[model samples]
Target chain A: MDRFRLPAGVRDILPDECARFDAVQARLRERFVAAGFRFVRPAGLEYFDTFAGADSPVAPSAMFKMTDRDGNLIVLRPDMTLACARIAASKLGAESAKLCYFSDVYDFSAAGNSDREIAQAGVEVFGEAGAEADAAVIGFAVDCLEAAGLSAFIVDIGHVGFYKGILEESGLSPAAAEEVRACINAKDAVGTELALRKNGASQRAQRALLALPSLFGDAQVLSEAEKLTDSPAALASLLHLKQVYALLSKAGKEKRVSFDLGTVKSLAYYSGAVFTGLAEGVGAPVLSGGRYDGLCARFGKDLPAAGFAIGMQRVLRALERDKEVRQ
Target chain B: MIRVALAKGRLASSCADLFIRCGIRADILKEETRKLVLETSDGAFKFFFVKPSDVPTYVEYGIADIGVVGKDTLLEAGADLYELLDLGFERCKLCVAGFAGVRPDPARPLRVATKYVHTARRLYASRGEDAEIIKLNGSIELAPLTGLSDVIFDIVQSGGTLRANGLSVLEEVFDISARLIANKVSLKTKAAQILPLLAKMRGELAAKDEV
Candidate 1:
């Protein structure tokens, strides 16, 4: 019966949509290349353990798994940009590298959930660290979104350490900490308070935890958040975000930028300045990226770096909607 | 223009009252003849009446620049829209309820009936309990009584329904009140109009607090 309709969440990106997808991909590639990022392509499949570290949010069940020739567990690459960084460090020995790619990632959960395969076109800069690199990546993301005709959007900025540092300092058990992280990520304030209370955290910690969701706004959120965190690392992260904001202000994209201490990255690999571009008419983020200093280390290279990825599917969705409205 | 999607129920009526307090006419809301879209006289705003669950989707997709929906809708949809203000209306609580004393046990895979599968899954997962989720469209409270589920995940405003049915809330999951959510794009593109409207609403809310 029509080949079972390609499963519920998986479908063919028809010629019409693919044409627009390719045009967007080409525009991003040209812009990234002109900005001096070398193009790189990673295998669409990798060993499961390669993404099992602290930086990956890929659940094992979410991956399309298979047995390798050597009987090792392998899975289709759920995200090419991260795998690209892994390859750049291990295969190319490029600790400090700038790479751009256009590829489809296979996520099994996409079937019956969102869609299994996603066409993602974006850039990754490895080895460049600090506020300068963060600004550059965010600036590039802004350029890509604007280029795709998403003129009305905001780039929300946050640092992974901002929340992680506080959670670590809460003296929670590993399991409890993970639960708390999930709660905070979901913007479930009541759940967070209950989790913290059940974990027997101090009253001060519980109060601070409950306030996490409301601690998001413009740049002032940084200073307000700094007062809540006792961890030095968390404070340093706040300072780093301030420096990045200054850089964006100099670049004149500061108005388009907002601060969110509660903004959590979808991927576990983001280490600093995690951000997502939001626009009207799209159900998800148009673009997302952050600094992943430890990701390169996973591929046998130690380097500080930051980068961002444009969600081709979501961008196309916004563009198509805009076109429909205009017509 | 700022677009607000109001749930077509008690929350919508309450929101209309708040809008009137904030200097919005809100008379268009009274002409309820299945008209989906309504525009204010000043032509600076538009409102869409939609199902509470669909309000988040509309706001998240930027179809309506903003939305006035209960926190329950936000939790269920899990849309990435920016929740800007707590309108403090339609207040309720999401809870787990079952036959009086048949509490949640983590060891066994409990079956839960709910209209909010995402929220239920997350609630159980957060508690380190894995429960088989059964998604139902309506009358969730009837599931446990009918033996279709071990427990029911639903919103409780006063716990009257549960108590009347010989059930009690085993655990309260979340405190939900109505909130103002903005589409990430509309918040920026229409900032000149949207921000002022938001400021007015905030001013009115603050005044209410003062009174």
Candidate 2:
């Protein structure tokens, strides 16, 4: 039995899991199609560079690599959005287009003992620039979770520029700014204050950094955030969030959303709004996506884009947890 | 209604004392108990004793709503639970130690020994130093004495153990203290219960400090 060990992090998805997971994936795909997103499946293996293209690859090391007959080093797709983005740019051209995918992304950060290959479903809306475009995708994300019968979750919405607004004015080195972001993510206000002081940030900037984490709860938090910083980019980001909030509110999906000006996207290419969906029980996000207005340009097409991917296993875990609690 | 995972040794005893101060009955634990689960008289909470290292896993996986464990174990475990509050007990430091008056040979890849292999490796890696880490169970001091490794990384309290072993501190990595952590889900859903318990314990700690 020990000789038959699976490779590190690989697992067999048994029939029961396949049935449950497939049902959820199919429903989400149906939702995407009804929303006018044409479903697309980029090849399972791409040149490693293609997966690493535009956005830094999500799980580069975990990607199963192979040499093709032509001797090109190919990588199993590590993220669906990166593969989808390439399609939108190369095939769809500069046209404003919507795309969706149901795929598996290979990564080594699951359960610690084995790498997890995730079944991810997502949509990328390219060539949309305004806050309305941002709201549409975010609203779509909320609806998918709703269609899955998830009520105990939140779509934490944020703009990368809100963080950028402070970093640009604080005059901290990139290293120091990164430290501040880490502290903010940890919600360690004391740590953020000390880092700001060490970095010689202005008192106003320090004040904003300290208040950033708390800017998470309600639509009213945006107005509260304005009192902390007067930076133009920061203010514009807040207004963009406010307008997006108004749209969700009009759709009566506002309660499912919250804003965090201090949100940090570890992914580098996020150009505008960034959002994560966390359910009531899971500590990690089940859905994460953001606007990468700068991403398509790397593939030779300059276009605004926003997209998100839901971790299918995590969503199922949440659904399972919900089922147990209800029972 | 609530379940708490408590580290089953020194941290557990001190935490029981703290919970008592906060007026939560925990005497059932002090009575030479092997009982893994004990319920409070009113049955408002259930307490379960687990190994210190497993505390975070139990909490993070939602088997327990909350846990109390050392920052050292928490850091090494790297579990993704919300560190709700610092209980501020079991104070110590995760320090890098070596023989007194000895300089590490930078030319050779660093060789170290520790039970905390992850923490030790990360400590070296963060400094951009290449090091081989020998994992040991007890008496990490024997590693340096036996010449199995150049140095050892472990928790140091009051500098007593290091001095007794003729070891000197090279760098104090970070402070370690007991922290109260909560499952991500439990924190949101069971807040009405967990918050009051946290506030009471926090109040007890603050008042104790004032004395």
Best candidate, lDDT-wise? 2
Task: Give the distance in Å from residue A140's predicted Cα in candidate 2 to where it truly belongs.
Answer: 1.8
State the local distance difference test value for candidate 2. 0.81
Give the DockQ (C-alpha) for candidate 1. 0.28
Q: Which ten residues in a row have the lowest lDDT in candidate 1 chain A?
A: A107-116
For model 2, what is the alpha-carbon lDDT of residue A12? 87
**Candidate 2 docking: what grade?**
acceptable
How well is each residue in B82-143 modelled by candidate 1, as lDDT tens digits? 77777877788888888876655667799999998998998889789779999999988889
Clashing pairs in 1: A55-A268, A55-A269, A110-A115
Lowest summed-lDDT stretch of 10 residues in model 2 chain B?
Answer: B183-192
Q: What do the candidate models score in CA lDDT, each in turn? A: 0.79, 0.81
What DockQ, on C-alphas, does every prediction get?
0.28, 0.34
